[model samples]
Target: MKNDRRPAGHVVAIASGGLDSTTLAYWLKADGAAQLTLLGVDYGQRHSVELSYLEATAKTLDATYIRLDLSGAAALLAGSALTDARVPVPPGHYTDVSMRATVVANRNPLLLDLAVAHAVSTGADAVAFGAHAGDHTIYPDCRPVFVEAYRRMITVANEGFIAAGFQVLAPFIAMTKAEIVRLGTLLDVPFANTWSCYQGGRRHCGRCGTCTERKEAFALAKVFDPTGYETDGG
Candidate 1:
């Protein structure tokens, strides 16, 4: 059993309380890689409910979870569905390009930038995210290209004091949400503790794009979704 204490020099995971990130945390932990510091960004998104789950997930994994709220900055993006109630969260399976607006622009850059800083300051060797291929078409920042760029930047940017610089890892960059869910199951991640609804409802709206994808992922993985949700008979 892994202890909760932050390791002297460990790997840091970017945990958004979404399936992918939570799964990453569990996978790394299962591998007995090292102690992990779970990083969650509260960017003024409507689905703040997910933050609660982030806390629970971290606690369950015996990992340290820290929050960096960028809500004040994210609040400026009024048209994004994650921030604006009027945007009307889109429903059903949508491609990444079609779902682009939902992305908080510069979100990945800012989050990873801070994560890098955290890694350097704390002597962590790497920073990881839950970005998958499905996100690439819509969220360029989630793509491998961007990840590699950041990795290079982090290395060249911090070449002196910390010779053991940081690296950005995205293990699922080519997998789909369903594939991620499947992998998560293998890692023994507590799926119920992860939240993916874009709507800030008590239960998942089940109609939003995120909920739909999440439902489909579990379905594809041939696993039952244990989360609470209000679904319409479709």
Candidate 2:
């Protein structure tokens, strides 16, 4: 007997439990565009605790929650501040030079592979994630070129198995974090439930690149941020 945990839905959304992804979930649901399966990936990140927020988001959205653990890859993906204990998480603006240490080296392709595989396995038509404009500066994989090529590559990768009209969606691709925050405010996304700390501390380190970016996003959007930062750095 084979176990089948493949995500089954009109769209399997990768939920990172961060501001962008959580907002994406709420937006998709409220937009009434697609049936959602909130999928969370755990590649032994320092912030595995974010999965709990992901589960909370699933419940909030009343969507299927798939927590896929690829923790074994942590060893192979060492040196990244997120997966390596030795490398300290960088504290600065997200796009600054120091923040490059957070790159997991082809991380998005690996994560998106899960969405595609599950989409193919369950005959789902689409796979979605919340890669936004801010991600483009640091993450090569988050760029439109990569996403478009990835969609095509995956289509060819499983030509027979994939559903017709299958799509890899990154709706926030062109939008800024501030814009997303504004939209999330309109969507009533519980911002406090999202997690962005790379430190995985009791509260957001607030000094890390992501936290700084998160604070900046809220400020730029003129939205009141509910997140509690340990350092009050940003």
Candidate 3:
């Protein structure tokens, strides 16, 4: 069923070139979004290869691609394994204790703010991102409460503007990653082009929390994953 809450107009998607975000982009396109803009943030994370995927995805979807430089801010937000080389990217399932090392502070909030601002500037009616139920346990920003609060804040902040009725859309907020995979598969998303490894090697390490989760989601969804992994072992 199509979400009636989603306004019918230009929409900006926070694309990270990961499974979730890429899937979201494809979903938007499938839903006949008139004007779609993909916003990618370059935050100097270890998995910079995803930026390449971001570009490719934009081309595939025929959407305008905009890259924002947040590398300077990443320096101050160091200490997380993703942005700091000194810290090791943890290997295990997402629920493991060690996976907390990968959290970047206020990542979702910062990215959403940028996406929302871009939408406002472009006269877009909505801004979307892929935040699923699985992330709620590890990322507070991905939780429903945070998203609802952010939506309210954006509504209040844009008051009186010509295109003031902006929406923060998280279509998969209550769905599991496996469910997202199934939806993406149905939408024929190019999964092979998406990147999820924190190591940022030539191929996915297949050991990091993200890689593990990606593999698990595919398995749970019964979808054939086309991602190239460095190792056969999960």
Candidate 4:
């Protein structure tokens, strides 16, 4: 009898070089259970710093890093801060509806489609993302409901050709950014290697929505945050 249940397949991880995604990559590595392929999508966001950061992270983790260019999609969706040259990336919490300017239309869905394609082509059994609770508040696609729905979509979307099947694993969906930071620290994730500033500046703006939340997470976690921020208190 062939051992079909072996855990020896590639696992594609959607890495954006942010706190959550980077932490997810490290968590998978800590488990030491399967091959990992890191996917970093370039959707023409002002911040390319995170892409470079992910390359460094992949090097450190010794995982294969794939940079997929979806800048065309960003060009098409120009109203959001992430793609538009006019709107500024709102400097507030993820819950602030105004901050929705950063969300590209169906952005997560697009990236997940590419990731799922790669998984099917490579015979991987799973695809992972870093959609934590904070994102669920703002991004419609990052919520648990979307994740589950997408899981079923992909499964049916990639039927018998991919005999093994796939699952959308979100290990941090229920946790706040603070709790994620705390847990990631415990996993020895190199937070310093990650970048969260959406301003595309030389250093973290420290005032943007992502920066504020990142600061708040570390503050709440009581961990020494290595992010380059000018402010001292949240």
Identify the candidate with maximal lDDT: 3
Expressed as tens digits, the lDDT of each residue in 1-234 for candidate 1 is 011223334777877888888888887787665678898888889887888888898888888889887788666778788887777777777766449658777778888878878888887877778888778777889887787787777788788744363457777788888898888888877888888988888878888888888888899889888877788533
Q: Considering only N, C-alpha and C atoms within 3 Å, which residue pairs clash in candidate 1?
A: none
Best-first order by lDDT? 3, 2, 4, 1
- lDDT score of residue 122 within candidate 1: 84
What range of 10 consecutive residues in model 2 has the weakest lDDT sum? 1-10
Which model is ahead, 1 or 2, in terms of lDDT? Answer: 2
TM-score for all models, in order of appearance: 0.90, 0.93, 0.95, 0.92
Q: Candidate 2 at 116: error in angstroms?
A: 1.1
> Candidate 4: where are CA atoms >4 Å away?
1-8, 230-234
Q: Give the TM-score of candidate 3.
A: 0.95
User: How would you encode candidate 4's per-residue C-alpha lDDT over 1-234 as one tens digit per residue?
Assistant: 021122446778888998899998888787663788999988888897789999988998889999988777667888988778899888766666776777778878888888889988888877888888878766899888898788789878788856464567777888888998988988999998899988887778898888988989999999998987755453
Give candidate 1 regions above 4 Å deviation.
1-9, 163-165, 232-234
The list of candidate 3 runs beyond 4 A from truth reads 1-4, 162-164
* Candidate 2, position 156, lDDT: 90
lDDT of 3 by residue, 1-234 (tens): 133257667889998899999999998988888889999998989888898899999999999999988888779778899999899998878764776788899998889888888887778989898999888887899888898888888878777752755677899998999999999999999899899999999899988989999999999999998988878754
lDDT of each: 0.79, 0.85, 0.87, 0.82
